[model samples]
Target chain A: MQRKKSRYIVSYSILLILICVFVLLSICIGSVTISWKEILNCVWGIEKERTYADIIFQIRLPRAVAACLLGGALALAGYLLQTFFHNPIAGPFVLGISSGAKLLVALTMVAFLERGVKLGSIGLIVAAFIGSMLCMGFVLLLSKVVTGMSMLIVSGVMISYICSAVTEFVVTFADDSNIVNLHHWSQGSFSGTTWSNVVCIGVVVGITFFYVFTLAKPLGAFQMGEVYAKNAGVNIKRFRVLLVLLSSLLSACVTAFAGPISFVGIAVPHLIKQLFQTAKPIVMIPACFLGGGVFCLFCDLLARTLFAPTELSVSTITAVFGAPIVIIIMIQGRKK
Target chain B: MEKKEYYFHAKGLKVGYKKKPLIENIEIPLKKGEILTLLGPNGAGKTTIIKSIIQQLEPLGGVMYLDGEDMFAMNRKTLAKRMSAVLTNPIDTEFMTVEDVVGTGRYPYTGKFGILEKEDKRVLKESMELVHIVDIAQKQFSEISDGQRQRVLLARALCQEPDLLILDEPTSYLDIRYKMEFLSVLQELSRQKQVTVILSLHELELAARVSDHIICVNQEGVKGFGTPEEIFSEGFISTLYGIKVGNYDEKSGDLELEAKKGKPEIFILAGNGTGSALFRKMQRKRIPFAVGVLWENDLDYPVAKALASEIITVPAFCRISEKKIEQAKQCMKRCGRVVTTLDLSILQDYGSTLRELYDFALQNQLVEEK
Candidate 1:
């Protein structure tokens, strides 16, 4: 017991140190270089004049914070969906929750541009939430008809494909500038994040995290399989629905604020499992939070630094890093 | 040791899907340290009753009590701590080790964080030892054989350290030997640990041999629930399966068919791990039969020992000796017909003996020439 506790503490501390380093790196390496001293001074409000420190503080800090929050939220959502559905491949994008949000955003943009109207971020967030909830509603309905996880995953993938087709049809008829913005948004980036959006994502992720944590015991019971979980005292229907709602909420929040960031939601939870050697959510949940934040921070750094002034999509970088890690882990598992 | 008493009591229990009861208004008392085998053919609602007792499927009409406490009111963790279960389907977990899989039984006691305490580890170790899978503790669960996997599942349930253990068709996929071994282990566990074990098994003979109490669920509701002798003798099983039970021999504890007259005296030329199931089938069908030329140490010796027949046998490993072959020919002469099990593993060099028997049968016109 003592050894286990010590190991946990050591892991938590190492993760904490890694998060700190990533945060510092996020603040340091951007389009404009700022010294560590200046970054600290700006954060502490010691500087009295408008300068590069102001730009870093105002623009990059909020973007980085938003990335961390969105990454953690998306990963947690993926973790919950995977456990609830008992499928390793179930995720926000695979299940069409993110695509649902994308469709809503795309429709809202086309409607606004067509009517010559300008909508605020809050309106977009609401549209995204409604879209995700509708998708969740459909998935939950299908879950009743479908008894198996693999079939449910296939159903979700089908829903995503349908949603993507609809979004493409909408984009072809929209204004060129609006289509460009929609295309860039669909690719997913942290460039549009501000303080208010960060706060909204943080609040939603915090609330959903607490709710999901309360479900840890039932989720662990679920890991044993559904019949055993039901015998073990879980009201399987209620717990499953609760998990779906929580996961959908988290996915919607991230997609609403940061657009549809792909691999982070699908791959971060699996990466955390590889790192921790266990899927017990108590460990994996927090590990996913830290690991996801670090991953997104690093990806964002690469997105900014790789081609200098030419910014790459953050999702592209994440997929490049995450796909190989998943394949390698899968190969190793197969070898064993 | 204190004599622990546990009684699973149901009052006016009704269970089914969609709130319309499949089996309703039923009550049964299951006692501790006893093996109660739920005996039924398919679609008899045995699974429903088991589910209701464990509170997996909600009781549509009534209440169940475990040790006088209301089962429905108990929290999931509390219920899990008291009752561990093994369902029919194998859980598909990709990466868990055998020990890790079994250790999950401690989830109820380990709190939400699921950190294993020293006591939890001790329980896990003891359970693995009890199930005799300690050697495979470090191996991945997917690497084991089906029988080994079943034992590992039993170990996992044992690790839960519950007062009552429930299993649904625990022997469905096992061969006969493993089936017997699995039931024997359950019997031992019930006796040694003072735990109440309730399982659904299709094998009536094995259930008769192992269970302390038999609950026979037929289409006509709960047919019977009592000791094996009381339940088996009540003709409930015969009615349940719609088969005759006259072959169920009481004295020898072996089933023997009442012989039919004017039929061929079919002497079974089988031995060495063959003829047991065929013997039972023939006996159940009331077909007259005999056996010969079996070695003393062959696997079929036990079945022959149980059957009321004349057997010619030589010393162990004395294959096809002269005296035994003569005895076989004499037995074939006395009988009007013959049947032989084609054991490819054995009797490959017995072609001459087979040809001799065939020629004799053809010469006497005892059987049509083939």
Candidate 2:
């Protein structure tokens, strides 16, 4: 027990240190880079009007915080879905939830742009939420008809493919000054996030996190299986609804802000589980949140800085690192 | 006939899936501390009944009263606080220790976050020790053997501190020793804690030995329900299992498949139940044989009844009669060999009869097996 406690402490400290390093990297290494000293001075009001303050406070700070919140949301969403389906590969992106959210957000953007109206942050998140729930409903229905977990994943991927196809179709035809930014946002980057977007994402993701954390107990019982979970006094009907609502909400919030980032949902929870060496939800929820936040901060930094003055898409960067972890899980699942 | 009030009873229960009944009219009255077991063939709805009782599958139509309260009407939280089950489907969990798995049984008592209090942890430890799984308390659940897993699952069930424990074929995949140990754990728990148990078992011998009350179910319906003595005496188990290939001995709780059927060519003088192994050997070799002058109450009577092609029997304690001796002679006329399971005490008790049998084998040129 003492050894186990020490392991958790060590894992938490490592994650905290990594998150701090990545947060600093995200703030210090963007275009027109600012050093930590200058960034600290900018925050302390030494040069309030300088380009460094403008860049750090107005631009990079919100984007970095958005990455932390949305990235953690994506990983929390992944862990719940994996627990629900009892499949290691189950995730918000692979299960088409983010694609569903992105499709509706894209449609909402195009509809408002054609009317010469811009979609506010709340409207996009609400639209994405409906789309996410719609896809989740169909996935639930398909899960019942499909006989195996593999088939369910295949169906999720097919759903993902269809949604992405529709989203890309919208991206092709909608060409305006607003659609140019829409096009950039549709490819999934943490750029251009404002302070208001950060507050909105933080509130929504924070409440969902509180609810998911409260559920760590029953979620632990639920990992045993449905029958045992019910036998353990979990109100199955209510618990299931909560799982669907919370996972969909978290993933939808991510898609609303940063478009559909892939593989982080499926990859980061698995990496944290392996690192912690236990699936106990109490430890895993916070660990996954930190691990995912650091991962996305690191990837978001690279996405903006790898070929500076020519930013890469965040999905492209995350796919490069996260897709291989998913493949490893699949191979190990088969070998076992 | 029904003088005492049963602590639990089901009246005209209809158990099935999706409103379709497979086995209906299941009437059972169980005392508070009794261990009742359901014995049946595959797909005979034992699991269905268990699932229904545990509220996994809603019963199609039934009024199950537990301690005089409608079972289905009780709030699930209250029911969950009182009842727990171990199903046949294996729990495929990852990274959960045996203690963690067992700790889940404290669900009804824990706060919303399920932080285990000191009492809950003590109960978890106590239940694991009851099942003698404290040694493997730190082992991963998935890494253990099936027997250990079953024990751990049972300990999880026990951690509920339930008044009633329900198990669906809990010993389906365990070895004999583990099977006995599993049932004995149930026995100990029910006896000490008054945790009424209703579990289905596949091992008929274990079922006969362990169950305080027996329930026989088949495709038709509930065939019988009573104490083990009342149920095992009526040849109902064989009928319940529909055994045409094998025989179930109600007397000894033993089972056997039918022997090779052909004309008898060897006769054996057997007594005091010494020819059972040889009888099985001949049956395996497909050789037809007959035995004579054995009492009906010998130790090998059930095996002999199931395997021997021909048997000539006398009363349980009487000497061999002239008519039976003549019948044995007639039956052994086609035999070319004689085997005796005789000893010196029997030779002294029936010296003249033994001498006559030996001389008969000699005169007929039948080779005597030493």
Candidate 3:
């Protein structure tokens, strides 16, 4: 027990340190390199040059915080999903929940933009939430029809394909004036985030994360499986509903803000589990949130600066790092 | 041990899926510290009945009382405090240690964060110790053997510190020794702690040996409910299972395969437990055989009765009469060969009368050398 506690302490400390380093790196290594000393001076309104302060306050800070919050939200959503289905591969992106949200958000954006109206952050989140619930409902129904985990994952991949195809169709044949704006968002990036968007993402993800944290006890019981969870006095029906709702809401929040980042949801929680050597929800839930932030911050940094003149979308970078972890989980699952 | 008031009473319980009752009117009267076993073949609604008692499924048409309180009326947490179950559902977990799994049984006792208190930790230690799983507490739950996993689950259930315990085929995947050890832990728990145990068992011999009360369950409902002696009555298990090809010994709770048929190919002079091995060998070889002039009270009587094609027997404590001896001669003469579990060198030691039959077989060259 003492060793386990020490491991938890060490893992959490490492994640915290990594998050700090990544956040600082994200801020420091942009198109124009700025040292931490200059960044601090800019924050304190002591910088003589206004361009550095303007860039720090206007663009980089909001983007960094958004990546941290949305990434944590995505990972927490994945953890809830894996627990719900009792499958390690279950996640927002893999289950096509993010695609579902992306599809609707695209449709909503096109409809609103065609009318020459602007859609707010709240409107997008509400649309995303509805879309996530719809996809979640389909997945739940599919789970009933096909009891095998691989079958469910296969059907989820199919759903993802169908949703993404429709989304591509909407983006491809849309009005020429809207294409430029729609194309970048469709590819999924942490760029173009504003202070207002950051506040919205923070509030939504914050409240949902607190709720997920309070569910740690029941979620721990649930890890043992449905029957044992019920025997442990957890109201399985209600608990399952709560899990679905919280997970859907969380993934919806991430999709609303960041436009469907891939694989961080599945990869971060798995990495956290390995680091802690335990899947107890009490530790996994908070640790997943922090580990996810660190992962996305690092990935977003790479997406921004890996090629200085041309930037890659966050999903492209995340998939490169995250897909192999998922494959490893599948292989280990087969061995078991 | 003799409490006048019943601890758990399930009166007219109807259990099944989705409001369709598969088995109805299951009345199990159990006292504190007593073990009630549900026995039946597969798909016999034994699991259904147990699930109802644990309130996993609502009773379709009846009320169950635990310690004189209506069970269904109690809320989930309250019910969980009083009762715990180890189900047959395969527990698929990832990255969880045995201690992590066992500590979850304190769900009802823990506070909001579900952190184990000092008392809860002590209970966890004691429960692991009771099941002899302390050595594997730090091992991954998935890495352990199935027997160890079962015991860990049992320890998890024990950590609930329940007054009433329920298990569904708890010994199904266990080996012989693990099954014995698991059942003995249960027996000790019941005897020492006065915990009321209700479990379903597929092994009739284990059930007979461990259960204080046995309820025979089938699709038709409770077939027979009584002490082990009453339920395992003569030929009752055969009737219960619809055994068409074997014999069930009520006294020893042993099952025997169907006997070979037709006329005798071999005859043997055997008695006092020596002939049973030869009788089983003949049964396995599918050869019909006969034995001669043995007393009914011999140690080999049960197996001989189960497998032999024909036997000439004398009543216990009776002197070998000439009629029986003549009957033995008739049996031995029909077979082309004869074998003896007894030594022919001690032919006079067995009885002077039996020397005539062996001498007859020897003169005809019918006896096979051992």
Q: lDDT for each of the candidates?
A: 0.76, 0.87, 0.89
Q: List the residue pairs that clash in candidate 1.
A: none
lDDT tens digits, residue span A74-173, model 2: 9999999999988889999999989899999999988998898988889989999999999999999999899777898899999999998998898888
Ranking by DockQ: 2, 3, 1
True contacts kept of each: 0.42, 0.77, 0.77
lDDT by residue for model 3 over B56-109, one digit each (tens)? 787789878888888777888988888999988888878788998999999999
Candidate 2 lDDT over B1-370, as tens digits, reads: 2244887788898999877899999998998889999989999999999988888888888688888788888887798888899987767788999999999999988997888999999999999988889999999998899888888999999888898999988898788888888888888888888889999988888888999999999998898898888888847888888988867898888676678867887887766668787787888788888887678998777778888888888778678788877887777676768887666354655445755776687788774665
lDDT of 2 at A127: 97
Tens digit per residue, CA lDDT, model 1, A1-336: 365457667777877787778878888887788888877777788876567666786788888888887888888888888887776767887788888988898899789888999767678777888888888888879988997756887788788888888988998888988888777777788886778777777777888888887887777768878887776566788987798788888888888777787767668888677655567667778778777787788888888889988888887898898767556645764674
Could you list the iRMS of every candidate?
2.3, 0.8, 0.9
lDDT of 1 by residue, B255-326 (tens): 444434333366776665667777666666766667766667766665665553566666675557666677
- Candidate 2: clashing residue pairs, number: 0
